[model samples]
Target: MTETAVEQFTEHQRKRGKRVSVVSPLDAPFFETERGSLILGDCLQTLKSLPANSVDLFVTSPPYDGQPKYGNGEKYERDWYRDFFMAVSAEILRTLKPHGSFVLNYRSKRRGAERGVLQYEMIFWLREQGFLFCEDFIWGKPSPPPGKFNRFLKDAVEYCFQFSKTNDWQFFPENCLSPARWDAKDRERRKKLAHNYVRANAPSGQGRKRVQAGPDMVRPSTLLHLEPEFSPNPVKHPARFPVELPSFFIKLLTQPGQLVVDPFGGTGTTGLAAERLDRRWLLVEIDPTYASIVPTRFENGR
Candidate 1:
């Protein structure tokens, strides 16, 4: 947009009592590439401009309920978090397509070296918002964060809470299938058997392997074993997640050319994944510096 157009747009928003600073990206700094857009601004406010039921998938990790770990995150207690998510999620529910999926990756914060009920309280709040508790998965961190407190060991896992508008949301399980588990020695025995199975392991512990044929196939478990990524120039963002992490869900939950959104854009991991998977993405990052890093990532992500 032209400078004059931006000025006109800014003036128009001011007449409606909306703060232009929070919406500056609507004019100039809002950028778009072939596969995605990188908007530098508050996530909740940006959702208002998007059309309803436009997004096919939302794969993001919020501010850990306003924890102090991230630079912009504020330390808030359970009650505050419950209400905060209630507000932000209403926008998510609105923009999400009828069969879209909202994948929230979040973990509870520790308080004074002790555990709290923040995670539970927040889950209850999400459920109350009329979002279906579709399925809960674990993001298993192979390398956990160092323990600084006395109460617990190193933090190794976090929840990937899947929320759907309804139970009939899109899910392509075949996209995330894992290699079938088969012992090298057992392969020869399998060639002679049809629908091989160790029926002796049943509850009765007496059933034989006499069933029909079964294929050598398997799929990923609810537990996703992915680790954090290391960038030579991580810039100001230290907790950058790997691109494969988002790619997994993008492939499973969305099809090519569909819209995918990441409210907490971070290092543009989700956006890059969307690009590789032939999907379009809309990403928002509150920190301008982090948001600035997104475009370059699409060009030379390494």
Candidate 2:
């Protein structure tokens, strides 16, 4: 027998032996810890209850267009991309503060030699939702999934689209600085030319300053090289991103005590990253069992 959504919520609370404050009951706050809260429900529905402009940063990777089945993850038709993510974008834009940033990761799908357009379509749609197209980063995975066909070149990259509510948002480039890899000869050349000033063409009404060999600092680039070794024994999640992935964005876009959100917290990777960085988090997962995995994964390393 199928229980109603309200009935199921009440039953879940009773089974868990905890009292939850209820208003409409569609959205249920499943658990809370020192670092953050976890909600067990559909993100689209649960996100509706959050206050407007309350979140500081959002680091998430929604299920891509042609992903395999996972717990409680739906399989939308090919034509469902635009409307589905548009609704989600509107909600995310609402919860995001004027100075908030959203970093989204989407993978490119291939059907034989054909390429998918969901990732590009999402960028345009999110922009229409008033999110400024901040930047497009590539996660260059030297080691991609095994078992590739000969029809297409081995896929080795995924897209991370960074967006903001307005043109301005919180960002700390210093937080995720990449290690410098300058060659010895280049370093020596720069040192020899330190006293020399390199001039550039000045634009109209703009004065150009001479380029100097400033501090040998390295800023993170649009291409992120995050490649982790795969283990035969992984967690139950079918599509769990590495903790470092979200951690990079969390440190780059947010600060301590600021609120972070993951509308698609598969195995709570984002939440764990936020917790480690002293940022408050809100994770919304649709599957009860998967949502149940978050606390255990966070409190004790998995």
Candidate 3:
């Protein structure tokens, strides 16, 4: 879009009014819970209209290049994917607050006969554009669906690339610690400790893991294992990230009431996670048919 086009779109959005979405102010049912609202329309247009630095966290699994569309039946050919990604990612960067982060879920392509390395080029692209490279996690699917017998097990993992707009970003570790327990080895080791030393620290007969503070402090793993749920929508999108994907990231990245945006909000999984987390959300869906169903699914969840 040109300079004039962007300016015009921004102006139009400022005055788009409550009617642009199905947000019903007077409807008690809609406001019964504090969950954020969902909008229907093209994500590119919706994202462009958003105020700069308005979002706290951006997390999404944009449709894979040349892959099947979710909610919408269109197919994206591989040739057009790179240019497509660059455009969308740039807009996402623009919408994010300086202290915010973007968690992108993507799969590496199996383009040729030889096995390829995990794709990190996109990570470099994001970093060069001023987003800080935080960490890269591998989301491992313990029970992945089978693929053709001719090759190795179908790629059972997806990359979860985390980027921060600023050096200091939000991360809470106390929220994710496992309870300390007394294993057999710990119990045996305790028997040999000096009497006074054991007496003071072993009251509960459990050895607690020392809590540490810093960047290396218990950051969540990139490899996530989540069970896929059945979707009522007859036509399923080929690759869909689990709701746990967004829920986990949201918990670690933002606080309640912070806004989360997903430029590629397919089936509103990100919004669903945001709602459960008590966070505000703004979603963009280009395919009207898919856009319409998102709110319906939320309003009448199965």
Winning model by TM-score: 2
TM-score of 1: 0.80
Query: Model 1: per-residue lDDT, tens digit, 1-302?
Result: 34543454456457656676534676644546677787767787888888999999999876654456556556555655666556778889998999999988877766675666676666777788888888888888898756675656778887888889877899998888887767766676775775665556668667766543345777789889988675654446745677887898898898899999998898788999998889999898777656655555775754
The collision pairs in model 1 are 195-213, 195-214
User: Global CA lDDT of candidate 1, please?
Assistant: 0.76
Model 2, span 24-130: residue lDDT tens: 22543655678887776678887888899999998888776666566445765455567766777789999999889999988757766688777887888888778
Instruction: Choose 1 or 3, whichever is better by TM-score.
Output: 1
Q: Which model is ahead, 2 or 3, in terms of TM-score? A: 2
lDDT of model 3 at position 11:
47
Q: 175 in model 3: Cα distance from truth in Å?
A: 2.9
Clashes of 2: 0
Evaluated against the true structure, the overall lDDT of model 2 is 0.75
- RMSD of candidate 1 to the truth, in angstroms, is 7.8
> Which regions of candidate 2 fall more than 4 Å away from where they truly are?
1-28, 71-73, 188-217, 228-235
2 or 3: which has the higher lDDT?
2
Best by lDDT: 1
